[model samples]
Target chain A: MSAITFIDYAGVAVFAATGALAASRKQLDIVGFIFLAAVTGIGGGTFRDLILGVPVFWVANRDYVLICTVVALVVFFGAHRVESRYKLLLWLDAIGLAVFAVIGAAKGMAITGSPAVSIIMGMLTACFGGILRDLLAGEPSVLLRPEIYVTAAIIGAGIYTGCELLHLPGPVSYLSGVFAAFAVRGGA
Target chain B: MSAITFIDYAGVAVFAATGALAASRKQLDIVGFIFLAAVTGIGGGTFRDLILGVPVFWVANRDYVLICTVVALVVFFGAHRVESRYKLLLWLDAIGLAVFAVIGAAKGMAITGSPAVSIIMGMLTACFGGILRDLLAGEPSVLLRPEIYVTAAIIGAGIYTGCELLHLPGPVSYLSGVFAAFAVRGGA
Candidate 1:
C-alpha cells in the first residue's frame, strides 16, 4: 500500500513537470504553468473517477492538487537550467505513463471487476492527462503521432489484468505491468 | 422544468451535429462520427459535473448518449445534401453555447450557491464541449480563434448569475442569458 501510494505521487509529480515544461515552451506565466500542471497531473484520474461514479481523488484529497502545484512551482523556477525540455518531457511522460497505467487498472479492477473496462480505464488514465495538456497548450497531441504510446499503456494494463486472472501475488503483478509499460514506451 | 429539459436535450443534439460535421470534414467513418458526436455533446457537462462532485449527466440518464448517437447517424447520411456544413455547424454551436451557458450556471447555482463559481461553471459548460470536439477532430480550437466565442459564454453565464443575485424570476433570468449569448455569438 505504501509503495503504491509513493509511486502514485511520484507519477503525478512527473506528469506535472511535463505540463510545466509545456507552459515554459509557450512562454506562459506562473498561473498558466500551475493550471497546466494540475490538469496534466490529474486529468486522467478525474475522467476515470467520473465514469466510475466515484469521488474525484483530488477533490476528496487535496494533497494531489498540492503535489501538482508544488511540482509546477519547482519546474517553473528550475526549467531554465534544463537542457532539451522536450526530451525530458518524453522520458518523464514514459515513467508516469507506466505508473498511471497500472494504478488506473488496479483502481478500475477494484471498482468494476470487469477486465475489459479496467483495461480501457488504465489506457485512459495513462493517456488522457497528456492529451489534455497538449490541447490546452495548443501543442500537437501525442495521440496524433505515429509513435507506440497508447500501445505501451495497453500492454501494461493487459499484463496486469492477465496476472490477476492467473492469481499472481500483488507485487509481482504490479511490477510486471510497470516494467512492461516502461519497456515498450522507453524502447520506442 | 420541462422547458429547461427540452432545451437541454436540444442543446445536446445541436452540439452533436456540429461534432458530426467536424467528422465529415475529416472524412471519418460512422464510428468516428459517433465517437466525436458523443464526446462533444456531453463533454462540457461531464466536466462540470465532475468538478461539482455530482453524478455525470449522461451516465445517470442514457438519453443524452442516445441523442448524440441519433444525431450522428442523421448527419452521417444527410451531410452531403447540406450546402455549407461549416456554416450550419457554427450556427448550431452558437445555439448550444447559449443554452448550455445558462443551464450550466443554473446547475452550479443550485449546487454550490456561489454566483462566481456558478458563472465559471457556466462558461466551462458552454465552451468545453466545443474545445473537446475541436481537439479530438484536430481542428484549430475555437478558443484559439480571436472571435467573441468564450466572451459570449461569459456574458451569458454572468448575466444568469447576476439575475440570481437580484432574485429575478427563473424564466426571465434564463432567457436573458440565452439571448445575450446568442446575440453575441451570432453577431460575431
Candidate 2:
C-alpha cells in the first residue's frame, strides 16, 4: 500500500476507537458502538468525497468498513482496562487529525489543483469526523469551543499545500504537515 | 423542470424553513441560520447521492443552494410574527419529508434498480435532514425518540418502492407515497 493508504487506514482506526470510547461512555449498546465508529471513521472522508464529486472511499472498498468495525469492537472490549481514557482519546484524535489532514489535502490538490480548496478540504476531513461523533453523542462539538483543533488542521493543510506548490518531495511535505499539526494540537 | 425537480425544490424550501426555525430557537446569528438551513435542506440528498456514487444535487445545480438560502432568510425574518410555531414546523417537516422521500426513491430506483436499496435511500433522504439539524443544534435527535417520524418515512419509501416494482404510473406512485407518509406523521 502507498504511504497515503497506510496513514489513511491508521487514521480511520484511531478515529473508530475514539468513537467506540465515546459510545462506551454513553453506555450505548454494541450496535451503537459500531454505528458511531463507522460514522466517526468515515464521515469526514465521505463529506469530502461528496463535495469533490467522487465515489465515497469506504463504500468503494469494504475493507475500510471491516477495519472500522474491528477497531470499534476492540475498543469497546478493551478500553475499560486502559487508565486515563480521556488522555488516550485526545492523543489518538490528534494523530488521526494530522494524518487525515495530510491525506485530505493531497487528495484535494490532486483533484482540484487549487491550494486554497485543498487546504479547506484538509481541514474539513480532519475535523468533521469528531464533529459527527460529538453530535451523535449529544456532546458539545469541539467546533463550538475556543480550542486549537481546527487551527491545527488549518496549519497542517496550509503547510502541505504550500509545500506541494513549492514542488517539495512528497514524503518531506507529508511528514512536515503531520508534525506541524501534531505539535499544534499537542501544545494546545 | 420535471415533477421531481419541482418537488425537490419544494422539499428544500420547507426543510430550510424548518432549519431556520431551529436556529431561531437557538438564538443563533444570521450566518448560523443560513448554515443550518442549507445543511438541513441538502444533508439527506447529499448523503444519498454520495452513497449512490452520483453528483450531489445541490453542488451540481446552484439553484438549490439559492432556494435554501432565500427560504432561510425569509423564515429568519418572518418566523417571529407567526404564532404556534411548533404546529407550523411539524406540518412543514411532514411535507418536506414526503416530497424528499419520493424524489429520493425515484433517484435510487433510476440508478440502482433495487427496490430495497431504493427504499433505504428514500428513508435516508426523508429523515436525515432533521437528524443533521438536531445534531447541529445540540438537540436530541428524533431518532432517539419513540415518535413515528422514521416509521412514517419507512412507510412512504416502502410504498414508493413497491409501487415502482408493480409498474405503477409515475404520478400515482409519487402521490400515494406522499399521502401515506403524511397520514402516518399527522396521525402521530
Candidate 3:
C-alpha cells in the first residue's frame, strides 16, 4: 500500500478504538458501541460537510459507515479482556486526536479556501467527537476545561495550513501538524 | 395564567423531566442531570441557530440554561413518584412534543423568510432535542425512524405559517397550531 493509504487506514483504527473504549466504559452493548463508534468517527467530517454545504461524505460512500461498524465490533468484543486494563488508552486517544485533527484541517483547507475556517474545522474534527463522547458520557467536556486539547488542535491545524501554504510535501505537512498536537496533548 | 404561557412552561418542564430521567438511567449524578437537562431543553434551538448561520441562542443568553437546570432539579428531587414511574413520564413527553412542536414552528416561521424553511425549522426544534436525548441515551433516533413525529411537526408548522399569512392574532395562530398538534398526538 502507498504511504498515504497506510496512514489513512491507521488513523481509522485509532479513532475506532478510542470510541469503542469510551462506549465500553458506559457498558454499552455491541449495537450501542457501534453506534457511538460511527458517530465519533464521522461526526466531525459530517459537521464539516454540513457547514460547508457539501453532500455528507458518509452518505455519499457507504464504506465509511461500514468500516466504522466493523472496526467498532472488533475493538468492542475482541479487546474486552484487556481493554479497560490497558493503561495506554489515553495515549492512543491522543494519537487519534493528533492525526484526525490534521486530516480535518487538510480537508478544510481543501474545501473552504480559508485558513481561519480551516483551523475551526480542525478543532471541530479533533475535539467534537470527544465532545460528543463526553457529553453522552455525561462528563464535563474536556474542551470546557483549561486543558490544551482544543488549543493544541488549533495550533496543529494552523501548522498544517501554513505548511500547505509554503508548498511542503503533503506527508511532511501532515506529520509536523500531528507531532505539534501530540506534543502539547501528551505533555498536558 | 395565559393558556399559551401555561402550555409552554409545561412543555419545558416535561422536557426537563425526561432529560433528568434519562440521565438517571445512566446513573449520572445531580450535576450531570442538570447539564443534560439544559442540553435537552435548548439543544434543538441551538442546533437550529447554528445551521441558520446565527449565534447559538443559549451561549448568548444564560436564562435558558438556568431554567433547564431549575426544572431538572424540580423533576429529579421534587417529585419522587415521577422519578420512579414510567407511564406518566410518557404522557408528559408526548405533551411536550405537541406544545414544543407548535412553538418551534412559530419561531421558525417568524425568523426564517421562507415557508419551507420555517416548516423545517419547526420540525428541527421539536424533534432534534429528542433525537439528541435518544442518541445520547443509547436509543435510536426518531429521525432514523419512519414515525409520524417529524411529519406532525411539519404539518403543524405549515398551519402556523398559513395563519401568519392570514394576519391572524399571534396568540390565536399559536394556539390553533398547538391544539391541532395536541389533538393528533393525543389521539395517536
Candidate 4:
C-alpha cells in the first residue's frame, strides 16, 4: 500500500510533464497549460472513476491536482531545458505509464467488481490521458498508432493479475506490475 | 419516447454540422473531417453510455453514425455556404441543444434512478459534445463561459420531471422541455 501510494504520486508528476509538453507545443498561455496539465493528469482516473461510479480520485485527493500544477510550473520554467533533454522526460513518462497502469488495474479490480473490466480500466488509465492530450493538441494519439503503449499496460496488468493468482503480497504485485509496464514501454 | 427519438435524430444532425465546422477551421483532410464529425456527433453519448453501462448507441444502431456521416458530408460540401449564413448554424445548434437536453434527461430518468443526476446528465448530453469539439480543436468551450446553458437545462429538466411525476404523456413532456430549452437558449 505504501509503495503503491508513493509510485502513484510519482506517476502523476511524470504524466503531468508529458501533458504540459503537449500544451507547450501549441504555445498555450499559463491557463491553457494548467488546463492541459489537469486534463492530462486526471483524465484517465476521472474516466475510470466515472465509469465505476466511484468518487473521482483527484477530487478525493487534492494532492493529485497539486502535483499536476507543480509539474506544469516545472515544465513552464524548464521547457527549453526539458526539450533539449527530452529523454529525461521520456523515461519519466515510461515510469509513469507503468506505475499508473498498476494503480489503475488495482483500482479497477476494487471498483468495477470484475477482473476483465479491471484490466481494461488499467490500460485506459495509462493510455487515454496521453491519447486525449495528443488528440486535443491536434495530433493523433500514440495509442491509435501501432505502438507499445496499450500493450505495455496490458502486460503490466496481466502481471499484477498473475501475482494475485499466486497469492503474492499486494506490494510485490504492484511493483511487478510497474516493472512490467516500464519494461515494455522503454522499448525493451 | 417517440418525441425524444425525433429530437435525438435532429440533435445528431446539428452536432454533425458543428463537427464539420471544426474540420473546416482546421483545414482537415476529408478523412479527418469525417473522424472529427463522428467524434463530435457521438462523443457525449459515448461518454454517457460508457458510464451508465449501456450499449454505445451508435454502435448498436448504425443509423446514428449514418446520420452524422451523411450530415457531415453535406456540411463539408456546403461549408462555404453555411459560413455565409452563420446564424443558421447557431440556431440549429440551439435546437440541437434543446432536443439533446430532453433526450439526455429522459434517458437518465429511466437509467440511473436519480433526478439530480438526470439533470446533470441532460446538460452534459446537450453541451459536452460541443465542449469536446472545442477542446479537441483547441478552442474555448462554451460550457466554461458564463453562459445560461446549465440554467436552461435545469429549467427544462424540471418540466420533464414534473410531467413524469403527473404521469403525463412522454411526448407532451418532451415538447415542453424542448420548447423551454430552446426559448432560454435562443433568448440568451
Candidate 5:
C-alpha cells in the first residue's frame, strides 16, 4: 500500500479504538461497540468523499469495514484492563488526528489542487470522526472543552499544504505535517 | 417540477424551520441557527446520496442550500411569536418526515429498482436529518422517546415501496406514501 493509504488505515484503527473506548464507557453491548467504531473510523472520510463527490472509501473497499470491526472486538475485551482509557483515548486521538490530516490533505490536493480547500478538508477529516464519536456516546465534545484539537488539525493541514506548494519531497511533507499536528495536540 | 422534487423542497423548508426552532430553544445566535438549520435540512439526503455513490444533491444544486438559508432567516426573525414552538415543531416535523420518506423511496426505486433498498433509503432519509438536529442541538433524540417517529417513517416507506410494487401510477404511489406516513405520524 502507498504511504498515504497506510496512514489512512492507521488513522481508521486509532479512531475505531477511541470509538470502542467510548462505547465501553457507555456500557454498550458488542454490537453497539462495532457500530460506534465503524462510524467513528469511517465517518470523516465518508463526509470528505461525499463532499468531493468521490466513492466513499470504505464502501469502495470493504476491508476498511473489516478492520474497524476487528478493532472494535479487540477493544471490547481489552479496554477494561487499561488503567486510564481516557488518557489513552486522547493520545490515540492525537495520532489519528495527525494521520488523517495528512491523508485528507493529500487526497484533497490530488483531487481539488486548491490549498484552501485541501486544508479545510484536512481539518474536517481529522475532527469530524471525534465529533461523531462524542455525539453518539453522549460525551461532552472535545471541541466544547476549550482544547486546541481543531486548531492542531488545521495547522497540520496548513503546513502540509504549504510544503506541497514549496515543492518539498512527498515523505518530507507528510512527516512534517504529522509531527506538527502531534506536537500541537500533545502539547495542548 | 416533479412532485417529488417539490416535496423535497418543502421537506427542506420544514426541516430547516424545526432546526431553527431547536436553536431558538438553545438560545443560539443567528449563525448557529443557520448552521443547525442547514444540517437538519440536508443531513439525511446527504447521507443517502453518499451511500448510494451519487453526487450529493445539495452540493450538485445550490438551490437547496438557498432554501435552507432563507428558512433559517425567517425562523430567526419570527420564531419568538409562535405560542407553542414545540407543538409547531412536532407538526412540521411530521410533514417533513412524510415528505422525505416518499422522496427518498422514490429516488431509491428510480436508481436501484429494489423494494428493500428503497424502503431502507426512505427510512434513513426520513429519520437521519432529525437525528442530526437532535444530536447537534443536544436535545434528546426522538428515537429515544416512546413516540412512534422512526416506526412511522419505516411504515411510510414500506407503503410507498408496496404501492410501487403494485405498479401504481406515479402520483398515486407518491401521494399514498405521504398520506399514510402523515396519518401514522399524526395519529401517534
Candidate 6:
C-alpha cells in the first residue's frame, strides 16, 4: 500500500476506536458499537465525496469497513483496561485529524482543482467524524467548543492546499501540512 | 416544472421553517438559523444521493438553497409572533417528511432498481433532517423517541416502492403513499 493509504487506514482505525469508546460510555449494545464505529470512520469522507460528486471511498472499498469493525471490536473488549481513556481518545483523535486533514486537502485539490474548496474539504475530513460521533452519542460537538480543533484543521488544510497551488513537492507539502496541524492541536 | 418538483420545493420550505424555529428556540444568531435551515432542508436528499452515487441535488440546483434561505429568514423574523409554534412545527415537519419519503423512494428505485433499498432511502429522506437538527441543537433525536415517526415513513416508502414494483399507475401509488404516511403521523 502507498504511504498515504497506510496513513488513512491508521486514521480510520483510531477514529473507529474512539466511536467504540463512546458507545461503551453510553452503554450501547454491540450493534451500536459497530454502527457508531463505521459511521465515525467513514462520515467525513462520505460528506466530502458527496459534495465533490465522487463515489464514496468506503463503499467502493469493503476493507475500510472491515478495518473499522475490527478496531471497534478490539476497543470494545479492551478499553476498560486502559488508564486515562479520555486522554488517550483525545490524543489519538488529534493524530487522526491531522493526517486526515492533509489527505482530504490532497483529494479535494485533485477533484475540484480549487484551493478554496480543497481547504474546506480538508477541514471537513479532519473534524466531521468527531462531529458525527458526538451528535450520535448525545455529547456536545467540538464545533461548539472554544477549543482549537477546527482551527487546527483549517491551518493544516490551508497549508497543504496553498503549497500545492504554489507547486511545492508532494512530500514536502504533505509533511508541512501534517506538522502544522499536529503542532497547533497539541499546543492548544 | 413537474408536479414532483413542485412538491419537493414545498417540502423543502417546510423543513427549512422547522430548522429555523429550532435555531430560534436556541436563541442562535441568523447565521445559525441559515445553517440549520439549509441542513434540515437538504440533509436527507444529500445522504440518498451519496449512497446512490449521484450528484447532490441542492448543489446542482441553486434554487433549493435560495428557497431554504428565504424560508429561514421568514421564520427567524416571525416565529415569536406565531401562536403554538411547536404544533405548527410538528405538522409542517410531518408533511415534509411524507413528501420527501416518497420522492426519496422513487429516486432510489430509479437508481438501484431495488424495492428494499428504495424503502430505506425513503426512511432516510424522511427522518434524517430531524435527526440532524436535533443532534446539532443538542436535543434528543426523534429516533430515540417512542413516537410513530419512522414507522409512518416506512409505511409510506414501502407502499410507494411496492406499488411501483407491481406496475401500478403513478398517481395511484403517489396518493396512496402520501395518504398512508399522513394518516399514520397525524393519527399518532
Q: Second chain of candidate 1: TM-score? A: 0.98
For model 3 chain B, where is the 10-residue window of minimal lDDT? B139-148
Q: Chain A TM-score per candidate?
A: 0.98, 0.97, 0.89, 0.92, 0.97, 0.96
DockQ of each: 0.12, 0.18, 0.05, 0.07, 0.13, 0.18
Scored against the native two-chain complex, candidate 4 gets a DockQ of: 0.07
Instruction: Please provide, for model 6 over B1-188, each residue's C-alpha lDDT reduced to its tens digit, 9 standing for 90 to 100.
Output: 98778988988899888888887877776756776787799888888888787877875567787888899889888989989887898898889888888989999999999999999999999899988888887777888873699999999999999899889988778778888888898888
lDDT tens digits, residues A70-150, model 2? 988898888889897778888999998998898899999999999999999999999999998988777788798737999
i-RMS, every candidate? 4.7, 4.2, 9.2, 7.5, 4.6, 4.0
Candidate 4: TM-score? 0.58
DockQ of 3: 0.05
B19 Cα displacement, candidate 1 (Å):
12
Angstrom error at residue B53, model 3: 15
lDDT of 6 by residue, A13-130 (tens): 8888888888878888888999899888888888788788888899899989999899888888888898877778788888878888998899989987867668767987988898
Tens-place lDDT digits, model 3, residues B10-51 = 666677777777776777778878977777788777766665
lDDT of 3 at A177: 94
For candidate 4, write residues A111-168 as lDDT tens digits. Answer: 6657788788889888878886776656667776648888999999878877876789
- Per-prediction TM-score to the true structure, in the order listed: 0.62, 0.64, 0.56, 0.58, 0.64, 0.63
For model 4 chain A, where is the 10-residue window of minimal lDDT?
Answer: A81-90
Give model 3's TM-score for chain A to 2 decimal places: 0.89
lDDT of 1 by residue, A2-46 (tens): 988998899899999999898888777675677678779999998
- Residue range B1-188, candidate 1, lDDT tens digits: 49889999999999999999999999999999999999899999998997889889999899999999999999999999999999999999999999999999999899878776687678889989999999899887786563377778988999988988999998899999999999998998
Error of 5 at B187 (Å): 2.5
CAPRI class of candidate 6: incorrect
Q: Write the per-residue lDDT of candidate 5 for residues A77-165, one digit (tens) a residue.
A: 89999999989999999999999988888888888787866876797798889989998898876554534777788889999999999
